[model samples]
Target: MARNSADRLLRQFLLKAIGPIRRLGIPIPAKISKHLQFRGVVDVSVGSGASFKMQSHGHAIENRMYWYGKRGHEPETFLPWLEASKTAEVVLDIGANTGLYSLGAAATNRTSRVLAFEPVPRVAELTRHNARLNPSSNIEVFELAVSDENGTAILHDPGGDQPASASLRGDFLDCKQTEIKVRCVRIDDFLSEVNLSRVDLIKLDVEGIEELALRGMRTTLQTHMPTLFIEVLDARPELMAELNGLLNMGYQVGDLCSDGVIPYDLSDKKGVERNLLFAKDLSRFQ
Candidate 1:
């Protein structure tokens, strides 16, 4: 009981000190700031009158949002993500690291139901805690990895300050510190089991197994035709091949840009890493 009271006092003190430090433009190194300023769950103002609770230490997503806010974290994707969620009723956030997109979606649209899937256990718990911190109850966190199969799989964690880099693929991290066995589920099966008949938007960022996750959700993609937001890094040949299939299914691919989306060409050899939007109609975002 005494420990809890002390913790609450420390939390209150840190919260008070963070704003003044930020306003004064104190240039504290990120390494030091993580330990001192961003310990425990900290409240953050994420712009447009939206505030969120985040764990300041360990997870980079929370750390990034702590220092830079939401818009500053990933403007290209985060902005478009917010825009798309306005019309969505059901949002699937696969590879939901700390539930940023999920929380943003739920906050952007109070009626929208956000299903956040994160394979990492610790990060998944943090996402749930953050969800509870907010007033909205639309976000539901699932601590399971989405893949082509339903069985358990080995997930690689890069550890250290990069908790969001966990992936089901071994090649995803060169500095893999530990392996975790996580439950796997296909989007199609999971949706059916949950009795969800329709989905409006889907954001997939499962690091290396994006193609496999796409395969798992084939039924969802073909039937629901929900808009897709995918993060492609270096345009891996395998994932590109799967994306080509999506194109054949009447989905147009384009990179989410500041002004608008740039059309994506699969034939282009020098493909850079970026978030790509796949939809039957690309003008909706414009």
Candidate 2:
């Protein structure tokens, strides 16, 4: 049964109402959250004719559920993705936590092939479980981290229930509860190893290690020139270098907003902490 807007609103209100109580380790909010799911996962209907299967207990699942019920989440990001994938044959989603963009893309375009890469094994399995829920969607889930080089890295997982803040940054991971060694591969190397074709669109959100991931894909960026939708979190040293590297490599970077994609000025200290789009062709977005 579809949750009407009223039902969704009521659930959120209840969650908020018991938040303080729940924070005191009361477990009331958790019980309420558990009841919200019709099954083990909540179904969210994303635009372009697709629904996402989300873990009932995952991080930010509430807001994401609201968005799915409404048919889109982040319009600024989703709008461009929807547009780019119309003609895209291959799409890469890195750091695809529970496969939001990955599932969203696959749902939006049935003909497009979406590869979701998540280093966290547990999270990756969740992505797979969600993909299976959308049986008709052509989404592939991978459990390897992408970096500038091929090797293993210590991935910090903030627990399965709270995966939004997980990353490979040692400092960032240090604050988290668990650390696990994970195998990583560069986009270039992975493509060759798997014999995958050129990717037309890439959505990257690997925390502060965006530069390292980009470095590993220098060849792909130069040769394929895929459209990029990436998020830059905080003021990491790699952020500037990654932005500069994109500019040097003939890509125009912009910020996605409710209105749409706006020209990005990386030097602006205020805008460094937002989602960015890097593209060689801006016609689709325009």
Candidate 3:
């Protein structure tokens, strides 16, 4: 594989220019951050964009990494919901991750209410902070993990320049172990406690724990039938099964890159690690 001119230039700029600027503690502007296109760069924009009072809490809202004084990448899946305000009433942000989607939804007046659920303590705190920074009463932050059961679990925290997915099962390049006390709640259980009868949209990115959360939301899934945005990781078989389950439940499914819902067939198990969307009705968009 050969690197194109643009790729070579971007790499050189990142290593030579952007690296030293970050070391110098200089804050990059949102517009310049767009070039990096890495996950870490994307995460950093969450904080920077919020500080600058920009809506659409993408990776910029999470990490605040700036490339040439610009904020990082934005998740394309959120564009549709952001563009159409009135379509969504309540949003469920599973694995909220520094309040990107959560805060973004709160920024919109049409998003009546937002419930952000994050299990990681530090990330949860950041989510709360982002929510407060935005100043939306409709947003509620929960420092709990959504799983199949309710209990305490050990979450791995990989600390370093970028400390994400501490709960995941893997070794971090520059990381350490930290014990985070997390509450595991099912969707039905939490919604019942909050008295939420229906949810308009649900976004999940809990690594491999998505299936567990879906299992816990059986009642709500059958009833409200909210539009769901899910990140499917290739590592989990149960999560794949859960996607099959959604298809069996009469929901139309599509990936974020697609224009509309396509039939989900579990037989095609290639490229499971992609962002996908599911909805009971496409008319919701209309």
Per-residue accuracy of model 1 over 1-286 as CA lDDT, tens digit each: 9998887687568657776876575654666445444556755554567665656663555656666566546778887788888889999999888778888788777798999998898888878887887756588999999999999999988875438678887887788358899999999999999999999999999887888999999989999889999988767787888888898899988788776777778777665677889988887766
| Per-model TM values vs. the true structure | 0.83, 0.80, 0.71
RMSD of candidates 1 onward, in order: 5.0, 7.7, 8.3
> Residues 1-286, candidate 2, lDDT per residue (tens digit)?
3668777777667656755664464433333555443224666665555665665553455444532342335667876776777777899999898787887777767888999998888778888988887888899999999998788988877785547767787776556458889999999989998788688899988977888898899898889889999887765666687678888889988888776788878887786668888899665576
Clashes of each: 0, 0, 23
Q: What does the lDDT come to for candidate 3?
A: 0.64
lDDT of each: 0.80, 0.76, 0.64
lDDT of 3 by residue, 1-286 (tens): 3568778577557746676776676766655555544332222222223322322333434334234222233444655444333457888888887766765566554347989887777667777766765664378989887888877776666554234565534342245577666678889888989998888888888766778889999888888888888887673577778877887888877655545434455566774777777877655443
Local lDDT at 148 for model 1: 92
- lDDT (Cα, 0-100) at 93 in candidate 3: 87
- Which parts of model 3 are misplaced by more than 4 Å? 1-72, 83-85, 160-162, 168-176, 258-264, 282-286
Error of 3 at 133 (Å): 1.8
